[model samples]
Target: MREHPNVIAVQDALDAAGAHTADDAPSLVVILDEGAHTAAAAAEALCIEVGQIANSLIFDADGEPLLVLTSGAHRVDTAKVAAALGITKLRRATPEFVRTHTGQAIGGVAPLGHPKPVRTLVDTALAGFRDVWAAGGVPQAVFPITYAELVRVTDGTPTDVA
Candidate 1:
């Protein structure tokens, strides 16, 4: 199957950022047989633990887009996050808001390829996994990455999101 335009964008972004994936990686964008829109689905498809799946969640922080790369095994403590970032408000972005910020739907929001850079936070819990899977700009697509590489590629601050 041909790559989706969004998937291509993610590939280009990774290339430009010099992000490294497994040399023998199946594909820059791995198309799953079943939809991997949720962390549980992605984990099952990738045959990895749920904790290894990095969920790219976008939030509305006082009208600004904030990308939060959280671990599948945990839920983000919005209050804690706001306190950490010293922000007054941090709420989950709506579907429309997510699309506007990412140019992709909620389920497939990648860390990169946004119209512009959005402040990002990478969950420190992901450090426990050797390889983490992130959405590849489409529900059926995903890519492998490491916690450090994810932070570097997205220029995300590492923090305890749970």
Candidate 2:
């Protein structure tokens, strides 16, 4: 599991950024026995609140890649996000665009470790959780991180995305 390139990249990026969980432990990625293709599934697998799963959503914002780390409990209000970013358009990115910008597939995209840094927004709603779980470069892989750590590691702006 550690040998996977995407997992390696995510781990390296987490290490390089000095990310940590709410308990002050180093953030470590773990591969689940079952694949977690959605936040509800991830929450079910981990036995945690669905709101604790940070859904890494990629979007096309006026032709640029935008990453939104939103709480699984709520849907992203694209209109509000577009207004917040002062962009005329903001929509879900295609699978190709997601891969091209994030270097990982849609269901497994992590907040960091992209070929380049995509503009990111961390939902302020995520701050409600003590520890948030994000994809670790694959559908069955995930990692625990604090909201502050997520924002710091991704250099993401905290926004009310829901």
Candidate 3:
């Protein structure tokens, strides 16, 4: 199979987000793996612990896009996250909803390539890794980024979302 167009879009977004500048580039290694559609698959492909993979989960908060970049080893408790956001509810977004908001499919949402800045929350657990990997707008692609750099590129706030 060839590289998906969405992957190219992600590279462009990364460049536009200043994630691709030669000096500021955070050693993000975008790997293409046919089997890497989930965090487990990606970890296996990269030979890294699942916890080191940052899973970009999308949630809908009364129609608003809520992007939560959480650790692959942890499942986010929606109740706690909703309370953190002081919202009445939080639900997992459907694939279509996720695409509508982030312009990327589930399992392949890039941390910084959404059509707009969704209210983003970065899991505190991600800070444990000096380097982390996240999807690059396609299921078969991923890139390396640091916790601080991810936060900066996504305009996300670090919080205990896990």
* Model 3 residue 73 CA deviation in Å: 0.9
**Which consecutive 10 residues in model 1 have the weakest lDDT in total?**
20-29
For model 1, residues 1-162, the per-residue Cα lDDT tens digits are: 236788888888987877775453432667888678889999998888999999999999999999999999989999999998888999999999999988999888988988889999999999988788999898888889878788988999999999
Model 3 residue 8 CA deviation in Å: 1.9
Over 1-162, each residue of candidate 3 has an lDDT whose tens digit, in order, gives: 126666776676666666632245544537574848788999999889999899999999978889899999989999998997888878999999999988888878887767777888999899988678888887878888788878888889999986
What local distance difference test score does each model get?
Answer: 0.88, 0.94, 0.81
Residues 34-153, model 2: lDDT tens digits: 889999999999999999999999999999999999999999999999997899989999999999999999899999989999999999999999999999998888999999999999
Off by over 4 Å in 1: 22-27
User: For every candidate structure, what is the RMSD over all alpha carbons to the true structure, in angstroms?
Assistant: 1.8, 0.7, 2.4
Backbone clashes in candidate 2 total: 0
Local lDDT at 119 for model 2? 92
Model 1, TM vs. native: 0.94
Model 1, position 119, has a per-residue lDDT of 95
Question: Could you tell me which residue pairs clash in candidate 1?
Answer: none
- Runs of candidate 3 with Cα error greater than 4 angstroms are 1-3, 20-29
